[model samples]
Target chain A: MTMARRLRTKDLSAGYDSRVILKDISLEVPAGRITAIVGGNASGKSTLLRTLARILKPKGGSVLLDDNVIHDMPSNAVARIMGLLPQSPIAPEGITVADLVGRGRHPHHGLFSRWNAADDRAVTDALTATGIAGLAERDLDTLSGGQRQRAWIAMALAQQTDLLLLDEPTTFLDVAHQIDVLDLLVDMNLSRRTTVVMVLHDLNLAVRYADHLIAVAQGGIHCQGTPADVLTEATVKTVFGLDCRIVTDPVSGTSTMVPIGRHKSGSVGQEAQSRK
Target chain B: MTLIIDTQAAAPASHARNRGTRRAVIVLNMLGLCLVGLIALTLSCGQGCLPPAHVLAALTGADAGGADFVVNDLRLPRALMSLVVGLCFGLGGAAFQVMLRNPLASPDIIGISAGAGAAAVFAIVVLSLEGWAVSAVAVSAGLGIATLIWGLSSGRGAAGARLILVGIGVSAMLNSVTSYLLLDAPAWDRAEAMRWLTGSMNGAQLVQVWPVVAALAVFGGLLAVSARDLDLLRLGDDAARALGVRSDATRFRVTLAAVGLVAFATSAAGPVAFVAFLSGPIAARLTRGGRFILPAAGLIGAILVLAGDYAGQFMLPARLPVGVVTGAIGAPFLLLLIVKANRNGGTL
Candidate 1:
């Protein structure tokens, strides 16, 4: 796999209609590594990812691909190098998994081109990589949530881009499924040297899975670095507006954030006295 | 899993895709055959009930006595008009439904047909226009109304529902305009306008058939070019864009071509009631929701118009207009679909 592709944003501003959600945010994604953007609800993490993916047009500045303005390039040319899986994508009623995944080859063909052997191989490989090859003939509506998400990921995989961006991929899944998805992403990153960037709601999972972490706050990036450097208590307090303690994760040997709420104080004496 | 298991699992996926492709091909061929049979039956069995040989002789420009005038001048033009007009409605309607991701968003339901109807009525009654001039006015008005509806409903999110609702409102308004025009016209002009408004194959000239045929060629060609891109749009704007489809451009091209098709057909055929609304869903059902439904839908549209015209003229107690018969069939289906959607919590 080519490791020359680089995705970066320079002083970018973007939003819906008139309301700017991300303002002058600048960041570079490390190629062939897993990067995670984490934040509280509506903190522009998704907006930033969408802007980079060119799903949302940047209001000012630019998202650059190998130092070229992404928006200025032909959309199909950019799509050939990068793929994005949105937060919620609709499946047409009664579409089979293989058929849906094959749609990922959209950028590879022109208006009059027929599906070739390469297209078939890409779809097969994607389905196999996502471990949903067995469910290829099944209707998407019949799949479990995890399996459905896997199908969607398989679609992005079929695109065969060097860069993959995902927005809240594990939002509706169980914890086991969340880990399953993250592990799959890591596998892709390691095996294919495919750059993976995702917006994660779970801070600990983001810290655990991502090699680099970016914290977003109030329409701009608050902090960014290695997980250990960026997931400190001060960054969490500022970015999420929540009091939290950062500790070493025993499982992953990475930083983990444990939020401290009004009632769940870890004082043993206070808990005992309240019980008495 | 080993390579053996992987190949085994992969087999069914390819098999399913092949099966779907095969099914679509078979269904389209069947629809084409049915359309041909209907056209043949229509030609051979009207009024005096000429034989196939006589009809064929007339069609081939060999003298078949009095059969020449009836077959060449009358039934052939009407059947040809139905064929082209049906193709236009089916293709245009399915394009709208698929692009909007709603089965109910056909041109007739969305005021495009009403626009053409209102214009034709205005031309016949007020402007005193005749022949091709009336068709030209109707086509222009249909295109104008489509543009207006698209502009009104387009925005950031949930544009499909907004477009459908806006179209319904516009349709109602245009229908009222058509009615009001009819109410004040002279008796002879009123009768002529009413026949046009209700959509009839009566006086379907060979000249009128050519414009719709030309429309089917140009606009249908445009639609064919964008067919794959339009199918991708079914996955929603974000996904389509990520897949490298220029969603806005595809939508624009599709909308323009589809409107051109509906407008031209309406101008020639006078807004054949519900033919546009009914074709897509019927074709979808017949094809079992295949990936490419436009061609099947177009064939179905042709069949419906041809069959409805034949049935209305012959089978009905009174010789009714084609629109009335199709309207009767379509209105009940629309109600059933709405009811089913409502029961499913407002999804179709």
Candidate 2:
């Protein structure tokens, strides 16, 4: 893929009132790849994502896309090219699945612009891409956690942006649903070559899916590399302070984890081994 | 009970409901006609009954024999004022409600009306603005108060909920200040201030109609131009900005428009109580979730105040103030809304 400066942040410092959360952070979100951001809890992972998306302003430095300052552009202009789905998106009461998906076309529209064939095509493509095309007419509030996540993803997809940023896309879902959402992401990556940046709590999933890993720690990046190299047992211990044995997954040959918490380490591993 | 999860209930709800805009237009036109009917009823229904034909004749200067002098002058001004007041109140109220995305965010309940009223009251009592100048200053004050609220609420993006809360607070302070001024005035001036404060169409004239009409005409057009932006605003600042909306600029422009609208309404009608709060909800309910209820709200507000004015003036021959009747009707609606909000689990 031909790579250019899609989004770059330089010496960026941002925070809420009175205290700075991130300082002197410089980073690049590579175009045409899935860049998984793996960090321990409270490492300003979400803050970094929000600043890149221009939802929060940096006190210092600049976030640039194609050499244009992000803060300078009208939000719709930027939104027409980039989509961000924050963790726990709120839905308007009684918003139908179609309506929620349709709102994703907001940036592409102007005042007095009616819903046209293009908007409909975008929404239809998004819902189908997210594998929720069958349920396009359903109310969003009534969808399951997994299905609702897809709906939200569909909304982002309708943006038709080259870059998609998701903040912990699999936060509250069950293990099965987490895999479902990840599979959808894989489909998107394979089909569209859409540049994806996301913060993931699950290090194993991060290792499994990411083409590149950006690991943030203590207000700045601790390391950035391919996940196989950076997600060793020692790195895991240092970042999250949990003991885990890393092994290749028998199915996909990606890294899999054998977590060791105090309560049930030995017997659980044996029971798992017998089952396998 | 089974929660039906049909993905194919009516694919692309808007496509199925292709009659959406048409239905809304038809309903709105019907509502407009209803408001006109209410105005006619208001004009000629009380103390002396005049034929509807004669009432129309009196209105257009077509009455040859001049059999409806009562309808032509006194009742006509009252009806006109109600129509104008209702339109302004509805537009302003509905604008605030949808813009804030909170039903509690109406101009009256959130203190937009009080802010305008206080400024107008100050102009009348303290600044001693009289005749055309009195209402003009009042309008300016109303705009000034709205500007102050919007300014106070300004942040990096769209006006946050905190800023709106601050506006509510500012409105409270202004209301108290207005009360104090009214209390300290000379008895004669106190009576005059009280009438305006409570709101009345009793002394309103045809001349007063032009200012209100003109204010609505100018400010209402600005609001129409900014309507789509306001619709996007209900999605919250972060969501809006992330979607490539210039949240700050949009908020600033919409706010300026809202202030202009609110100020003009207050100047013309002395804050007219709950029309601003009620009109938007009524219009939204009738429209079933269309964004920015300006035209429909204006019609509903016109009907409400006109009907309320008529009721106040001659419903019982008791000669109650229009404000009193609106308060009587509006207070119950407010309580019902609160109960509904509570039942629905939280804020809209």
Candidate 3:
């Protein structure tokens, strides 16, 4: 049987208890493309990501994974087709990197199935892919922030799903580490044709990395399309309330945003050009 | 860069060695401690007058004289009861610790055992009951208390910390009731009440051992099967769900099995101090990895009870009961863990 690669949400309304964070949101993640959801804080981007990942129950409408209603499907069946990494993934104390990664293979085995060589190889390959093979035996708590994030990504990768969702995967990293994480995600997309949906706080990074940009505002999609079309200066002002100049990145030829503050409207673009 | 490359090359080799050695150490410790505990039980059996050799002979049914009567009628039943009670406490405690993600969340501390204690005390002091009747009441009370705690803490997103808080409050209230009953009891009932209050394994009959064995076979098997789900739970709710774990259902079933195990254990042996509280952390420490180690904790719990009973019998000059000895040792450790947990701001 052929598996469906498309993930779409239909007018989904969800929240914690009575407070609805995401309202009447409809979105379809382009198959085999990197989709980045960007918005201000409390703009429902994370909630939308979580709802799409099936971690949060939608009060209205449904998330359709390849045409099947996700809420009706068994979670293990959904898990086999998709994976999610939360904003901050926690590792139980003293868990080795390899052991943590191996847990990702949960959907493949039943209650009594022994851990076979295929599971072992998948874990090893995930560790190697995330460049944490050397840290396989190291305790998770002992790793640096970037390495730890990679380990978590490795776990998601070991799921070997067609679609992967991440909420702020690079929130706590340094600039270099942020680029490293984005590059890894790009590599995963390019090499494996994995549909990646992520919420990113950095507008420029989102434009640079995402094949499709979803600008969220007021608990709804403000703009959605290719970065060049969706992330214009006016949309940035409307979505983030930040007046900004849009320019093409010298290296990636993607749209980049430069914020024009109250006093430095004309100098921002010059500064960015000089830095390049 | 050079150092990074070199260390990376050598890490997996040392890591493999480290894992192998740690595993070997855990196995050796479990086996060795069990042997020591069994030997201690045998030695403590002959404390009245007979020698250790005579106790051993009696145990084997070789010396079917006075030694046989003491060993079979008194020592053997007590020892077997201790073992079974310890297993139940260990498995139940380990399950709570893993499920709640806190070492301090044992059935003893969380009032499940206290419910059993309160009921048993009520039966013995107020109703003038003894033996199986008290045991039956204790078991039912334990289940009731667990249900109460679950009901109280089953709010939206009622995670480990909230459950622990509710449990602690319920336990404290139940403890007060138990104390009041003990104080109001007649002088004749005070001795039995005191033994029960402090968790004694004295005068353990063959009948007490059977119910616990049966409980362990049922509840212990359930807990063992659900062990993986408990491990998944430690990764927090969202991650567990993402990995296809039905968190709510798994939590419910595991809690029921664990509560049953603790209730049976408490009815069989008294609350028995902190065997449930201490076993999981002790097993985790001994194993030295992040594995849950439920079976290892169970073995450790069994060994601790047997050893604690033996220590109470022979180590102290006054010959205190098993519960008193365990309480004395475990209370300080509990305090230490509380302080450590607060300092780390990890889990309660």
Candidate 4:
């Protein structure tokens, strides 16, 4: 399934109030492929995601979604076509998982419209897709970290939008859960062809999971392309200030970075395996 | 991913079951029954030892002139005022809590009632006004307090704490203004202003009570129309917006409804302190409902004011104002809330 639509920005500048956080940054997120935006702590990765999500309006950039400027698009319309999972989005206390996922259907369900079979089907499908069908009745707070994140994703999925954006979805999870969530995203991309854009801290995971890469640094796009093309040693050093050995992951056949630290022996190359 | 495979507890139809509503209905019915008893007691025992039988007889249009006059003309209106005002305060406050997603968002404590009282006081002492014009003053004052609180709390998306704090500030300012007006004015108007300052149900007649009843109808309808949206609002803004609810607009309407509800009740009976605040929490606690239960909370509010009024004047040698009774009962409850909120880090 080749769903190759594209979201592009032309000279977009945005920030909080008057402070310019993202400079005249321009990039394209090709649909039907995961775009991992990589940068250090203040590289404006999250801001770019929010701007693309239309939660924060850009000052001067034009975000064109299939020729319709997303800035000019009604937020609900944008929200309907594209879903966003903001980092650390707080759920209302005591709301159940099914209720949380049910919220994703809100964009589809107009006021005064009765809940129908399709809504139920979509909610069930989202839960099943994320493998939370059994825990669908559980309170959101009771779920473990990874399970909760998947629930949040299931909420985004239940929107049934063609596009999905996630910010640091793996921030608090353990490595095993991180793999579980990334695996789900990969499966979602393959099966549904949902355009996925995310800010990922793990460099190797970004390369492994994302088909396209966007490296943001100093309020601008530093590099963007296929993961292997963008995840060069020079880009890594400039963006993350880490000397690393780049290798193709034997299993996934993607660019994987082994970060080089000073703790290794003088002759020993920096093959810092984070978690095997 | 500790999926644990628990099909029993997923977040779907299990939440939509009728338990919350059932609890609310039971509590409201009991409260309603007690209110009926309190009203009967109020009509029967006040300065006249008229038997419950006589009041019931007069209420049924039997021909006893003295009993008819007291039951139909005097105490009935007072009791009805307590009922209506309490409903206004309770339901209105509950609606506010659901709207703002905060327990501290009640009309009585958050300066809306203070705004009405302040405006009414200004109309009386500063402008030397009288009669139904105070209702208009009340509407505007309550609206003003709401806007000020909204303006102050805009940064935090009008979090409960911010609204409560800003409301307290405005209420304090208005209260001081009221005190100044009362203290500086002539002795002739002094006694009259005092009743307006403290919430009162004394000297209330049906004609005077109509404004509150009417206000409750309009405001209460507005809230009911928006009740489902208000219920979704307690789920946080993103979740609410995701649910296709135009949240900010809905919030505005809810605020307007709350202001109208409290302002009219204040105009009719004077800021019957904390009934609005207490009723919502009590209802939520008792019913364990998912979101705002406005009518249920309102029933509790009506019961509190009516029962408090009954216990106050008749239970004592001297007649205590309805507001005094409510304060005496509601203060300790407020203290308990403060302690609970403090222990829970004050978010409730």
What is chain B's TM-score across the candidates, in the order shown?
Answer: 0.93, 0.85, 0.85, 0.90
TM-score of 1: 0.95
Docking quality band of candidate 4, CAPRI definitions: acceptable
True contacts kept of each: 0.59, 0.37, 0.57, 0.17
Candidate 2 chain B, which ten residues in sequence have the lowest lDDT sum?
A: B1-10
Cα lDDT tens digits, model 2, B1-348, are 133433442245345234445657886999978987887677667776777787777777885356456876777777888887778788877777776666667777767778777877777778877556766676566667666666677744333456557777987787788888888676545436655566777677888788778877887787887776666555566566667767667666666666666666676667777777788777777765544267888888888888777777767567776777888788898888868866763233
For candidate 1, the TM-score of chain A alone versus the native chain A is: 0.95
Weakest 10 consecutive residues, lDDT, candidate 2 chain A?
A: A1-10
Clashes of each: 0, 5, 0, 9
For candidate 4, the TM-score is 0.85
DockQ of 1: 0.62
Clashing pairs in 1: none
Single-chain TM-score of chain A, each candidate: 0.95, 0.91, 0.94, 0.93
- List pairs with backbone clashes in candidate 3: none
In model 1, the runs with Cα more than 4 Å from the true position are: A268-276, B1-13, B130-132, B187-191, B345-348
Report the lDDT tens digits of candidate 4 across residue range B38-61: 777788887658877787789899
For candidate 3, the docking band is: acceptable
Report the Cα lDDT for residue A2, model 2.
24
Worst 10 residues of 4 chain B by lDDT: B9-18
- Second chain TM-score for model 2: 0.85
Q: Tell me the interface RMSD of model 2, in angstroms.
A: 3.3
lDDT of 2 by residue, A155-185 (tens): 8888888888999999999999999998898
Which interface RMSD does candidate 4 score? 4.2
| DockQ, model 4, C-alpha based | 0.29
**Per-residue C-alpha lDDT of model 3 across residues A201-264, encoded as one tens digit per residue:** 9999999999999999987889899998998888987898887778888999887888876555
